[model samples]
Target: MMPTPGFPPSTLNTEGTPIWITDLAAGDPNHILHVVRGIEPAEALEVLGAKQSLIQACELPDSTPDERTSLPAAALGIEPGTSAALLAGRIGEWTFVYDDSGFTYDDAATKALSADGRMAATSVYTINGDASLTYAVDGEQVQWVNIDDLVLEADLPSMPAELRAAFEAAGTIELEGFESGEADRQIAMRAACSLASLALTLSVLRRVPLLVVPLG
Candidate 1:
């Protein structure tokens, strides 16, 4: 299928490499459609300065889709609700490549790119078998506004000591996923999703500039 129209053409990076996208399934029965997406594998390795051997991808159990039209608004704690946006593309094998959540080869538009000459989004993700959802995106257009000061004011329990120190040092922490019981699971999922979305956005900016719009 063709990419959703109206989104600008993804931009290419300085090296003339066209960024691509791929997605990994989160593997929950009801939320099995949750995916980690962004640029293709090869480019991801190069950008992250890591090799492919580092990535570990996994598969999910086969099952029927859910019948519910509307899941609880507080089911996952995110608003507007979610409905299997991406399907499980690859089957079997669990591999991790730079463990990036941004873009990959299985995405819709990757087919449009020809051979090694062009770039496409490549996804290396797996099913966590949990109801909680997580994702990340990278793009130059997106802005990483610092809400730490505000979040700190909320005084939501102190992050882990090590993690807390890191956040304090950076004055801001990149999106992260932490398995801190049920209470923090939702927050972690949001962090993961934010990172995934931001990374994909950045990848889009680097490769398909025309389609991406950077946040000031």
Candidate 2:
């Protein structure tokens, strides 16, 4: 099991960090996959503030219990210096999606520079859990152009031998049970881990200039 030499971060590419991608499950109506992303801390707060201010400004009605929209920390799913994404990563929560649907993580990338550390622009992401997702920058959400639609996708070379084998194996048919169906479970478990690793690798490599390879 060789390790993927993770994707490049902002420092490597004159452009920026690479992105991870995967297609929606079979027969998924959208025929799309989500590229998990993060956002910088300062920018994340700025975006949130703008949305809060805007939403707070609107009144409910002319006279019927006309309460204003409150941008309370608890209300917006924000904390004194934390967010839903942070909570979900550290401790398994019932939900990871925010009101707008962003998943946050402390070290969501293979490299420290690439992972969101409460400041980097890629710390918080808005996932639609399908193709065509958005991420948070403070409060405003931004969308990633589909990697499939990118001219870049065509240029990406095959992932290194170890990683490519791992990715493909995840799609392999489950082996029949020898007993408690443990064989099939093991296959799925390994596959899930492989995919996670692949995502991190893709996120960094996707930024390489003049680099492209089709995984489809």
Candidate 3:
């Protein structure tokens, strides 16, 4: 697929790393990316049930994704792979949170994240080739798509017209056979992320001083 205009180019940072959303999605299969509009990173973390003290004290030094994942466990002196860390950063009015270890697809959590007339969307890609995108607005799920289940439903009455159109244009609302290759699946997942206005890349992740919240 050709790069979309207005989308950030593959090299989105000074480091010149050719990072794109599809690359990240394909490389890291078991991960969740949450994009919350009109909220600070700290507020989003709090909405996800992270304690304020822990959020304040658990900012890991800026490091590679691997280091970030293991540093939290080492710092807390816990068994490796036992602690889950959430990395989040703010861009404009949206705060993006990346969870490489687990998924937060709980209804209550999604609603809470979109409370107070906010908007929240999450894109989850599992290792089993199942991918999902959930969008909530003002505490209600407005759009949802599960690739593996061939489910694509948008609350047209409540969802913004632009978003609905974006989904349609990106083929997110079209249900067909599951993508067979990892690259194809990554492209599909990246489309979902794009609909939620999440143009994340590894360079962006590295440049932004993400707040690391350790979940043990």
Q: Pick the candidate with the highest lDDT.
A: 3
How many clashing residue pairs are found in candidate 2? 31
The digit string of per-residue lDDT tens for model 2 on 1-216 reads 122233223211111111221210111111111122253322222232223232321111112111221122223333322422111110111111111223222222212322342211122222232222222222333222232232222321343443234334433222343232122212222222343343333223323221101110
lDDT of 3: 0.57
Write model 1 residue lDDT over 135-183, tens digit each, in one string.
Answer: 2223211112122222543433444342233223222222235221212
Every candidate's CA RMSD: 17.3, 17.3, 5.9
**What range of 10 consecutive residues in model 3 has the weakest lDDT sum?**
11-20
TM-score of 3: 0.69
Model with the higher TM-score, candidate 1 or 3: 3
lDDT, candidate 2, residue 73?
26
Instruction: Indicate the residue-level lDDT of 141 in model 3.
Output: 84
Tens digits of per-residue lDDT for model 3, 127-174: 575666777889998767665544235233454775555444344211
Candidate 2, poorest ten consecutive residues by summed lDDT: 86-95
- Score each candidate by Cα lDDT: 0.25, 0.24, 0.57
